[model samples]
Target: MADEKQPAVAPAPDAPREVTSKDGSSHEEITTPTRPPGWMYKGFKVFGHELWYASPLFQLLLVSLVCFMCPGMYNALSGLGGGGQVDHKAQDDASTALYSTFAVVAFFSGSIANKLGVRLTLSFGGLGYVIYIASFLSYNHNQNHGFVVFAGALLGVCAGLLWTAQGTIMMSYPTEDMKGRYISWFWIIFNLGAVIGSLIPLGQNINKVAGPVTDGTYVGFLVLTLIGAVLALCLCDVGKVQREDGSKVIMMKNPSWITEFKGLFETITSAPWVVLLFPMFFASNTFYTYQSNDMNGSQFNTRTRALNNTLYWLAQIFGAVIVGYALDFAGARRSVRAKGSFIALIILTFAIWGGGYAWQKDQVTREETAEEGFVTVDWSDGGKKYVGPMFLYMFYGFYDAAWQTCIYWYMGALSNSGRKAANLAGFYKGIQSAGAAVFWRLDGLKKPFDTMFGATWGLLGGALLIAAPVIWMKIQDTVPLEEDLKFSDETVADVAGAQGAADQAVTAQPEAVRTSKEGGGAKEVV
Candidate 1:
């Protein structure tokens, strides 16, 4: 401060500008390139910036709410109203028909979206959902099983569109580094919606209400459907992204849709492991069928039935959270190791839970009969004698949670790199529907088959559970891409350089030209 300070000298006009890379490398800065208009950065953001907070959350919540309400309405109609024995067979046929339709429609919708883009596809799907819901609400009130089945078929189509588009939107938001975390959060929220959905029926007094279609219960589904339609309209288009040159890039163009569809076919043909994941998914569906069948099949009173549903959802929540966290951590550390080990754990868990149920049924039968001191006990009517252990309920809950977490994470991870995340999700769900269809038929036959029926279904589930790990092991060798980083260092550098160049170019414009353009006149300059 005591010495006189020298003024800073400006750089020479020819002097090179310095630029820094993310890795700390330096380079001569050149005039940056100009970016095309309307290029926006599409990548991960913190908390409120997450894509999950966008329309996806709303869609998910709406879907969950509708799902929750539909079952309640069905249960109230079929079970609560002193209605004659609800045709369980007819219900299965309806569900099967719907699922079959959903599968086919999902495949086509995915292809169409790839062609027409997400917005149109989503809008169409949302509108379809609105129509389907209206139809269902109208017919369900009148106890029109035929119309209900028809409406269900329409709903399936809507589900195909909504689910495919929604899945694509969710996966498109997160970058690789944060994909696992984001997906985990997404599922957690999704399940939370399910929890809320489960509670809707409970609050609406679906079980207690004596009248035909209780107040607010039927209306709740309609409200949810409307909300879903609105949210679907708001979904972000994942197909649009900015290229390095700041040009608009469409991931899948018109001709590319066919190529992508063919690619999906090739993927299935070549990557057999992807196909293998299907059976495990199917096994999980079997459990769901088991639970539904048990609910409908059992003679449990209203309170017990409600308790069963509550427990089922509670277990699902617990399982989803725990397994989701585990999968995330495992993926972070070593994705392959995590996947293999997780699958194995799931398989073992399913085996134990399924085996335990099988054993518990046998044990309870022996205990009850032994207590009666009957040498030749005729336990012909197994309905009165059959008692599932309380512990089995808890075990079943845990198993379901673990199974679902694996399915979601596995499919998400597998399809993350592909343009067909929606299709994959749709296909997986479609297969689940197919499994439900098969098992529902089996459930109908349980009357004549007795305990053998339940045991056979459990065995099939176990077999599928066992197959998952084996298939995963084989598929593990085919390395799928991990999360794709949105803004790589090179990309960032390119952007920064381009921006700097644009600024410099403008700055370098002559004052005379600028003055001329501003109407100061060339004579003034002379």
Candidate 2:
């Protein structure tokens, strides 16, 4: 007979008991795996098993699907340069408002997700997306900038909740070995939303030379987003989620508004090293304005822009896969993978941005002589010229995916607990949105293309430099459980105190050993 599968080991001493379902029908398992497995295992089935519902990969897919509909469609519209409207200014103005509120709300959204519950927060998050897409549909008919801008601001609030919860789940749900792979999977599914959403407009606007996207396009996007929103209600709470190995997700039980807010402050104070990544976060989305508007939108006509947009997001899937595999290369240590990814990011950044600078000079020449603002590169007409800019836009998409994957991977390195992951995700999105807000407003003011391009290049380089010290010196083979892992019922103060005590105890070990040797020549015994 084939060797029988071994039973899982008992849980570690400090690990929490598995949580039970609200209705008491099922109990979460707290067994330990002999070793971490890949995305699949022997006898793995896609459905009709308890493990399938509670699996981290499945949960990650659920969030990915939600994002694929909401932000994915949002990206499809945004990538169209002017939200598929002829007027770029209104899109710019609306983006400014959207990101401004997005920054503030996202910063606190982690706490909000914790206090209100991830399911409810996520369900509400999709509402803003629906409303925002509808505003675009209304703008197509009415030309009302005010309503569109208002919708932008409202969506910002909802996006904050959805993304914070999304981040928390992404970071905390996976085993250490699975973090990178999980991110890649989530990104692929999430961006597919953009890819598929782009297809709708690409198909509809294929023949029309130059005009706003049809009402049918917006309605289609709206329906998909609404479906995503309703699906959010189906997410399993963190308390009940179990990893493939049967370990429980670290959760904050019975969190109140007071504790939740206090926990946010503590995440900063306790893990101050995370601030080193703020510049990386800030630079993350800052280049979207230059890439989408100045380059793709200004350079291509309606149909070609849609084609380029589809390819841009398509590039993201490849980018995420590349970086994701690199980060999770099982042969290397986690720290080595992290440091290597950073260096690769730096090389890719310079290469892509440097190529962009050369392309921008050519774009500048065309802009000065063109009759209208748009430089009108029709894919059907221009052969050699079209290939260069389209490829450039696609590379821009790749660069974006690599940068974001690195950031999420770095943050995931810091902690595995759901509570801390939520705060870190919030901080990242908040800073990213703040930076985007500034750059989008600049685009609205009609900043020189060269200026935007130069800023993007400089900011990316500087952010990478600022993050070097932490990536090199601070990242470890593994985070200490005593330091990062916490009991569900512990308050912020209790968690901090435990960490402080752990530090003190660690620091005192050498001194005690020295004293013992000196007092009794008990070096061996001691």
lDDT for model 2: 0.83
Worst 10 residues of 2 by lDDT: 492-501
Off by over 4 Å in 1: 1-90, 119-141, 170-173, 206-215, 240-250, 255-257, 330-332, 336-348, 355-397, 444-526
Q: List the residue pairs that clash in candidate 2.
A: none
- Could you tell me every candidate's TM-score relative to the true structure? 0.66, 0.85
Q: Encode model 1's per-residue lDDT on 273-366: one tens digit a residue.
A: 5765666656555555455444322433333333445555566666666665665563344356445546555565656556555643543232
Candidate 2 regions with alpha-carbon error over 4 angstroms: 1-42, 45-51, 365-375, 486-526
lDDT of each: 0.48, 0.83
